[model samples]
Target: MNSEQRKFEIWRHKMVARQIVARGITDPGVIAAMETVPRHLFVSEALTDSAYGDFPLPIGEAQTISQPYIIAEMTQALELTGDERVLEIGTGSGYQAAVLAEIVFRVYTIERNNILFLRTRKLFDALKYHNIVARYSDGTLGWKEEAPFDAILVTAGGTQIPQPLLDQLAVGGRLVMPVGGLCSQELVRIEKKADKITTDNLGGCRFVKLIGEHGWKE
Candidate 1:
C-alpha cells in the first residue's frame, strides 16, 4: 500500500482497538468489518482526515456519519453470524451500511434525502459494494417488498420504533435504533421472538430525526 493508504490503515486499526474493543464490543465480525471498510472514503474530501476519529462527521443534507463506536455498537447488537439479509433504515453517508456489508450476506438501505441517496449510491458502486442495495424513499415505511429481514438497523432517531420495521423483522431477528424525541434518544434493540417481542435499551444516543409517514412529519 501507498503511504497515505498505510496511514489510514493504522488509524483504522487504532479506531477498532481503542474506540470499539475498549468500549466492550466483542464481536469479531464487527471488529473485522470496522477495520476493513475505508471510512475516509465515506466523508467529504475536506473531512476525510477526521473520518477515523471517534466522532461523527457531516456528510451533507443535514446528515452525519455515526461515530465508529456507535456504529460498532449497533452492528454488534445485531448478533450477525454472516450470511443473513440485513435492512438498514437511513443510508446516511453509507458508512454504516458499508460496515454491515462487510459482515452480512446483503444489505438493503433506504435514504429519505434524494441528494444523500444519490451520493451514497455512487459511493457504494465505486467501492464495488455489490451486496448493498440502496433506495431513495421513506425509510420509516420499511422495505415491504423485501420484508422479513434477518436484521434491521435504523440510523436516525424517531419518536418510537416504526411499526413497519418491527413487522418486517423476521422471527428471532434483532432491530436496533435510537428512539425518543428529536434532540436526544435512547438506543434500543428489539428482538422478534416466536411468541412475543422483547425490547432492550442499549443506552442513550443522539441522531438526526427520522422523517417519514411512520416517523416524524417532515
Candidate 2:
C-alpha cells in the first residue's frame, strides 16, 4: 500500500488494540470486521483525519457516526456467526452497517434521513458492499417485509425499544439498542427466546434521536 493507506492501516490497528481490545471487547469476528472496514471513507474529507479517533463525528443532518468502540460493542453483543441475516437501524455514515456486513451473511439497514440514506447508499455501492441492502424509511418501525432477522441493531437512541423491532426479531434472536431519555440512554440487549424474552443493560450511551412512528416525534 501507499503512504496514506499505510498510515490508516497502522492507525486502524492501534485503534483496535487500545480502544476496543483494551476495553475488553474480545470477539474475534468483531475485531476483524472493525479492523477491516475503512472508517475514513465513511466521513467527510475534512474529518478523515479524525475517523480513527476514539469518538463520534458528524455525518450531516444532525446525525453522527458512532465511535469505534460502540460499534464493536454493539456488533459483538449480537453474537453473529456469519450465517445470519442482520437488520440495522439508522445507517448514518454506513460505517456500522459495513462492519456488520463484513461479519454477517447479509445486512438490511434503514435510514429515515433522506440525504443520509442517499449518501450512504452511494458509498456502499462505490465500496462494493453488495451484502448490505439499505432502505430510506423510519427505522423505528423496523423492516417487516424482512422480518424474523437473526440479529437486529439500532444505532440511534430511542425513548424505548420500538415494539415493531421486538416483534420482528426471530426466535432466539438478539436486538441491541440504546433506550432511555432524550439526551442519554442505557444500552440494552433484548434476546427473543421461544418461551420468553430477556433484556440486559449493556451500559450507558448517547445517540441521536430515533425518530419515527414508534419513536421520538419528528
Candidate 3:
C-alpha cells in the first residue's frame, strides 16, 4: 500500500485492537468489516486524519458518524450470517451501511437528509458497495415493500422504537437501535421469535434524534 493507505491501515489496526476487540466486540464479521472499510472516506477531509479515533465526528446536516466501537457493537448485536438481508435507518455518512454491506447479502438504507442522501449514494457507488441500496425518506416508517428483513439497524436515537420498524421485522429477525430521551439514549436490541419479541439494552449511547412521522417531529 502507498503511504496514505498505509497510514490508514495502521490507525485502523490500532482502532480494532484497542477500541473494538479489547472492549469485547468479538464478532469476526464485525471486526473484518470494520477493518476493510476505509472510514476516512466517509468523513470530511478536515476530519479524515481523526477518522479512526475513538469518538464520533460531524458529517454535516447536523448528523454525526457514530464512533467505531458503537458501530461494531450494534453490528455484532445483529449477528449477521452473510446470507441475511439487512435494513438500515439513518444512513448518515453511509459508513455504517458500507460496513453492513461487507457482511450481509443485501442492505437497504434510508436517509432523510436530501444532501446526505445524494452524497452517500455517490460515495457508495464509487466504493463499489453495490449491495447497499439507499433511499431518501422518513426512516422511522421503515421500508414497507421491503418488509421481513433478516435484520434491521437504526442508527439514530428515538423516543421509542418505532412501531413501523417492529412491524417490518421478519420472524426470527433482530433489530438494534438506540432509544431514550432527547439528550441521551440507550442501545437496545429486539429479537422477533415465533410469537413474541424479546428486548435487551446493550448499553448507553448518544445519537442525533430520529425525526419523522413516527419519530420526533421536525
Candidate 4:
C-alpha cells in the first residue's frame, strides 16, 4: 500500500484492537469489515486525521458518521453470514452501509437529508460498492418495498423502533438500533424468530436524531 493507505491501515488496526475488540466486540466478520472500509474516505478531508479516532465526526446536515466502535458493535449485533440482505437507515456518510456491504450480499440504505443522500450515493458508486443501494427518502419509515431483510441497522437514535421496521424483519432476522429519548439512547437488538420477537440491550449510545414521518420532526 502507498504511504497514506499504509497509515490508515495502522490506524485501523489500533482502532479495532483498542476501541472495538477491547470493548468485547469479537465477531470476525464485523471486525473484518471495519478494517476493510477506509473510514477516512467516508468523512470530509478536513476531518481525515480524526476518522479513526475514538469519536464520531460531523458529516454536515447535522449528521455524524458514527464512531468506529459503535459501528462494530451494531454490525456484530446483526450477525450477518455473507449471504443475507441488509437494510440500513441513516446513510450519513454511507460508511455504515459500506461496512455492511463488505460482509453481506446486499444493503438497502436510506437518508432523510437530501444533501447527504445525494453525496453518499455518488461516493458509493466511486467506491464501487455495487451491492449497496442508496435511497433518498425517510429512513425512519424503513424501506418497505424491500421488506424481509435478513438484517437491519438504524444508525440514528430514535424514541422508539418503528413498527414498520419490526414488521418487515424476516423470520430469524435481527434489527439493531438505539432506542430511548431525544438525546441519549440504549443500543438494542430485536430478533424475530418463528413469530416471536425477542429484544436485548447492547448498552448506551448517542446519535443524530432520526428524523422523518415516523421519527423526530424536522
Per-residue lDDT over 85-161 for candidate 3, one digit per residue giving the tens place of the 0 to 100 score: 99999999999999999999999999999999999999999999999999999999999998889999999889899
Error of 3 at 146 (Å): 1.3
Superior by TM-score: candidate 2 or candidate 4: 2
Ranking by lDDT: 3, 1, 2, 4
Candidate 3 residue 110 C-alpha distance from true site, Å: 0.2
lDDT of 1 by residue, 1-218 (tens): 99999999999999999999999999999999999999999999999899999889998888899999999999999999998999999999999999999999999999989999999999999999999999999999999999999999999999899889999999999999999997899999999999999999999999999999998998
Q: Estimate each model's TM-score.
A: 0.99, 0.99, 0.99, 0.97
Ranked by lDDT, the better of candidates 2 and 3 is 3
Tens-digit lDDT track of model 4 for 68-138: 88888889989888999999988899999999999999999988888988999999999999999989888
User: What are the lDDT figures for the candidates, one per model?
Assistant: 0.95, 0.94, 0.95, 0.90
Model 3 weakest 10-residue run by lDDT: 201-210
- Model 4 has how many clashing residue pairs? 0
* Model 2, CA-based lDDT: 0.94
- Report the error of model 2 at residue 40, Å: 0.4
